[model samples]
Target chain A: MLDKDIKKNESADNFVLRLFVAGASANSARAISNIRSICELYLKNRYELEIVDVYQQPLLAQQEQLIALPLLIKKNPLPERRMFGDMSDLKKVLKGLGINEVI
Target chain B: MDYSAKNKSKLNVLPKTPTGISGLDDITRGGLPQGRPTLICGGAGSGKTLMSLEFIINGATKYNEPGVFMAFEEKTEELILNVASLGFDLASLIKSKKVSLDYVYVDRNDMEETGQFDLDGVFIRLGYAIDQIGAKRVVLDTIENLFSDLTNESIVRAELRRLFQWLKDKGVTAIITGEKGDKLLTRRGLEEYVSDCVIFLDHRIVNQISTRLLRVVKYRGSTHGTNEYPFLIDSDGISVLPVTSLHMDDVATSERISTGITSLDSMLGGKGFFRGSSILISGTAGTGKTNIAATFASSICDRGEKCIYFSFEESANQIVRNMRSIGLDLQKHIDAGLLEICATRPTMFGLEMHLVDMHKKVTEIKPDAVIIDPITNLVTVGSVNDVKSMLIRLIDFLQRGQITVLFTALTINKSVAEQTYEAISSLVDAWLLLRDIEFNGERNRGVYLMKSRGMKHSNQIREFIITDNGLDLVDVYLGPDGVLTGSAREAQILKEHTGDVLKGYQKTRKDREILRKKKILEATILTLKAEFESVEEELNRTYTEELLTRNILEKNRKEITNIRGTSSENNTEENGPHIET
Candidate 1:
């Protein structure tokens, strides 16, 4: 069935990613850039990135139980992954996001 | 050059924000500094939040100053409801736009630890609240809540500094409360952030009595009282009774008023107590200390001046009943709206709280005279020096206000030099010592004015009788016995009656003896007069017989010639001669 194939393709190819950061901090900027580069380089047209400023939306950050700034959450995937602290390590980021070796 | 005078002159009198608490503003020499953050640090359950909330609540109601209360620990409803017991209608105040509450809920999970964290969000919220209500007072209760979940301490410190600086820059008087630290004034060291003023509240147990004490730890630019004053958290809120007078600058009066007992007044220089002076009546139990106080209060009320009587040992009705038996109709004074009886148990409150209650009542009622019956009852709450200092403050306060105050203390033993009198002897302007003198198988009440600072008082103890007619001094011993009291007085009256009966009997006997002597003398005089008359009659009879015999003889002899005429003449001459003899 073409419908089942389309659903499977949407789940596997289309990525939902969210980035939480404090306002205008250097670490927040670095985390934002690194996460953005990773998403754009790995899944250019396949990912949907949502950037949220924690200070501006503290309630939203609280709802997500955020303890640290410059945090990233991968949604819409089979298993969700959370990464924070030293996000500049590309290998660690890729390993936490569970990216395939082909990507 | 007087350097002390120069320094005193150079002192800067800072602008103050009134706390609007009874006796608190007086102790603070106005209040906390204006446009500055004052830190109120205390242990848990020490009433830190309640005190700060009272500041804001009093600001809104009394000073007409709108306030913003940003609670870091409790919700707005909880804070409002909790302070309602203090008669602070915060909900109504907020509803009327006089008070604004913003609970800054900081969930630790959302607040991450970092090297740099600005309290800009908090400042924005507080500033918004202040602007919305046009508030002039702010209270931030508990500053440690923001860092409860934070791992880094440096950021919390920096943010606290900025927060206080921003609050001061806003030109609003603020109060910041914090938990007391073991080694520091505050757990998070918030006292360092607030540089203008710092207040420390402590809840301590002295003699098993929980007493809340408050002191101004530091006030940078103003002269404030430095004594630890006991505060009360009752239905009325925190009221601190600071040292009443820093200097004895009272304008003493030389006018004297009676103690209602004429004899006692005579003992006190015949003019009674000095107006506006504190009188201490020290006596043993049942020596009539309360009677003395009741008489004094009754006299004050009779003079058209109001008097407040505080009876810690007896209820109002009990005092009235007891005083009635002493011929002091205190109920009439109460009915006339001139006498107020405030009766409570001494163990109900500590010395400071008791003093606060007195201050509140004094301020509210504004009586011309105050009577504290048995001031010794307060000794159970504190040490000797403590009660002494409390009385000193009380006396100073009443004297400075030109209000007459009387304190009755019970001396429990024969060693008056080492008992209650020793505690308040120096503070009282006049002291009257009442004692129970037992002599000749009788106990008589005697009162002596030991000292009247500005008047000459009698040192001799005068035995006084409290009869149904009132108290009177027995000027003399009567009825072949000594001065008597109670049934002894009645027995003396009966003895005098018997003596009068004996005097009457002796008087009648002497009258009877005089009557018998007068009767005997009258009988003797009558006998002598009767004897004289009888002798005169015998002489006349004898003379008559002789004249007759002479006439017969003359007749016989004159038979021969004119004998009858001659005999008749002879007889007449003889009769007249006999009568004369």
Candidate 2:
């Protein structure tokens, strides 16, 4: 399974991510910092991140059907994935974003 | 602040919001706790979604309060389409800003949780919708889906708790639905948070019949009905039946309504039945129970009042046609809008559904009288106790509405009939038992007034007859043999009439014979008297002759009376006279 994931990762495209959060909540700030650092360390220059505050853009939250704050969605991956919570666990975030191996 | 103080000064009771669903308000004593979240838990297909939807819709349309509905399982379009079948115009309400629908899609496979989080996104979305419509009521249908979507149970629980508190702070009366758990009220124990009010719905199938029930498990700071009330989901949405008001203080009226049979009315203390009273007519099959019920119904309509007939055994047209044979024109009343006939098979619904349907009909029609043709047919769908309970509630409801009702029960036999009568007889104000009196190789109908609560009623069984003209009661003939009915009664009457004629003829003959005898005897006496007179005259003549002879011999005894004496004297004088001659 690791060899297959390595082969798929070799041909994978740029990572497109969108993080939905409330305005300056402690959890949202932690999730934003954690995901940015993880992306910069793992897939630098190969990932694009967009952050949306649900309080400012409630229509976006409604359209995206956001339930939990600090929600992150990987839009570019062939199989899109969503993660809830403040991304405190690096290993779990990497696994959820399908980063099986660290560059 | 002044209003709050006034409310507090009155009874110190918690103010409640009215949920316009039928009978639900009565059960909750008013409605759900105002400005608090009420947890509604039920199993699949137990009408949780529909109930909450109705709450929101009723609040929006009836109370002039806008509402927000957040569905977790179904999307907004699906919700609108689904409730459209129940006669709810969700789209129009949404367009008019009276209702706002938000569908929250929760898929476990699409989401992953990395660390701690709160449900602020849901709060913002819900808050936005509520603010958009200024909604006073909110519904979260099956929020248990979040438990499945999110893996961390503790976080979800904490977030849900906060969300409930936030909703309370928003001052909106909220209903949160949850799926039934194995042993708990809800799968995720949502009741632990929304503690102000908890309602449980159940759908069960007993003996091949399905029934839905609603129970108010708990209502903090207020008293509510603790019984499991049966509810129904028809085209008009869910309606709960709060069976049996514990109070027996229904007002009684002295107004009497006719039974449409004069003799029958005469048997019932010269009146038929008390208004707002329940009457039971129990009889065997083909004993004309329906005929009696139809007669009463038509009589109600004849007074320019309304009547609703619930027929379980036959269709409306069939009842009308059959009643026409006995001269009851039910169709005319139906055409005049004074009568309505509802026909359905007994097996179509469970006993409680029938009851709820009946309550709905009574509320809708507001009829003066209601007739259930052959309530015994309900026994096929439920136990005797179930039917009895249903009927008790029905009678209570109708009586409370001040509507008279008539029930026809088919009694299979004597013992069973007595059992049924004993079960229902106590609940009814009047009971008329129709029996088939089999005698002289014929079967005749006899109606007995088993009981009439508040008035004088005849105890004697009347000979019930149904003819082309209408129904009537004949006084049961008491003859030498026994109580006679049918051909036996007619035969006895005929014999008595013949005997009277014969006795009259004999009396006249004897009178004429006595007159003839008296005339003959008087004639004989007259003839005899005449004879006597003649004889007396002859004697006198003879006496006179004798006297004359004697007188010739002796100086004449001239008179007859003195002849004897004179003759004796004249004997000598007559000799002397003769010698002188």
User: What class would a CAPRI assessor give candidate 2's docking?
Assistant: medium
Which runs of model 1 end up more than 4 angstroms from their true locations? Answer: A1-103, B1-12, B62-65, B92-98, B108-120, B127-135, B254-258, B261-272, B302-304, B324-337, B415-418, B439-444, B453-463, B466-515, B528-548, B560-581
lDDT string for model 1 (B84-161, tens) is: 877788999999999988776655432223232344446556766788789999998876776675555776677688
Q: Pick the candidate with the highest DockQ.
A: 2
DockQ of 1: 0.13
Q: For model 1 chain B, give the 10-residue run with minimal summed lDDT.
A: B108-117
Question: Model 2, B436: alpha-carbon shift in Å?
Answer: 1.9
**Candidate 2: residue pairs that collide:** B551-B556, B553-B574, B554-B573, B554-B574, B555-B574
DockQ of 2: 0.64
Q: Candidate 1: TM-score?
A: 0.80
